[model samples]
Target: MSKQNNYSYIGIAFIILVFGIIFVPRIIDRITKGDITRQESRSDYAEEKKAVDSKLSDLAFIESFGEKRKVPDFSFTNQHGKTITNKDFEGRVYVVEFFFTTCPTICPRMNVNLVKIQNEFKDFENFGVASFTINPDYDTPEVLKAYADNYGITNPNWHLMTGDKEAIYNLANKGFYIYAGENKDAEGGFEHSGNFALIDKNGFIRSRIEDGNPIVYYRGITSEDEQVNDEGEREQISILKEDIKKLLNE
Candidate 1:
């Protein structure tokens, strides 16, 4: 080979050696330490996604005597004066609460959290809320409509319902077992559980598992921003939101 050609070849060989000594080790080190993304990284990501899916899918169904506790049949007039029934909630994930428009305690906080939740899933057509008035006597369709508007509840699927007092109470106490009753001395002239129930697409009551038992209801009295309430109970609104998402996806 000519001198110039030999020198050109040598220069190219030296450059290759330099690249191998520097860049190659870094590239190899990155691969070894998992710092460089590879097909394995995508696999790892899929595994993580699967784990999340599993967590979301594990929401427990509230059961009684080995049979899943489905939402009891109900028919009530909504804020718009339209009759709503359990069938209306078919194929949707929803939250249920018992509150009177004039409740003096817990109801406001409960609804504030609910409205936050409503906003979170506002874009979801299959997500909704069912606010059954404990004081149906006072919460007529017009009254319920005013309450919904006052609270900025804009979700089209949401329904603030009122109906026959006896049926409403039975639905709350006997059907859902959520504890709604008349209490003459109670702050709002009535007492009801400040817990919210989550219903699945199939009308089955669903909840999260704690210690292998379904925690049948979520504490609606606590706000999502309050991690711990005055009773030192952890706020469940955030988890409720997550569970709602899970059910919605299902």
Candidate 2:
């Protein structure tokens, strides 16, 4: 062989030798340490994937200042005439709303949507609803019971609650930050926020994060069939249902 050809062969061998010394060991070390992505076991891969998915899929906490907000303690009478308190919802995922049995406008729509939610998660024992009546004087346990029957609210955990009017208002306005009051000028002689607040198993209020902020409440006035209302607000009941499932799993 020519000396020039021999030189070229040496150069090629030197490059190969350098690569073996510098990079091959790193590749082997990564595999040995389980740092190589493709070398991961199926179960390990699944666990890592689950963790990442959990971070992405988990709902946001409704926070006040830097502290996470939670559903405040409350005591009210349910349709069964049993006293219901915040303790009753421990270790359960629930939705909260304010309504009156006599409402002629938005209350029916709200309850209908709530019934749909109730039916969707009927099989899950840990899922529930807390419907607080804004007009407690008119919505006694008997009246609330009849209203629940009329609406087909069959979820055993679904509670139609009524108690002191001022306390109910305080819970709605100051506690949950949801609006509820006697509005003589409004339809049905009362007004309330047409939004539902989601509470997790631990009583911490939860919601979907959007644009780096917690939406805090789902629009109860919109049906799943109505994707967006005349006011251009998109219906959130579907997302709410999915979130309830997520919380239930958590």
Quick one: best lDDT, which candidate?
1
Q: CA lDDT, every prediction?
A: 0.92, 0.92
- Could you tell me the lDDT of residue 205 within candidate 1? 94
lDDT for each residue of candidate 2 in 27-88, tens digit (9 for 90 to 100) = 99977787555556776889998986775446988888989898889999999999999999
lDDT of 1 by residue, 153-229 (tens): 99988999999999999999999999999999999899999999999999999999988788899999888677899
Q: How does candidate 1 fare on TM-score?
A: 0.77
Which runs in model 1 stand beyond 4 Å of their true positions? Answer: 1-56
- Cα lDDT, model 1, residue 229: 92
Give the lowest summed-lDDT range of ten residues in model 1. 31-40
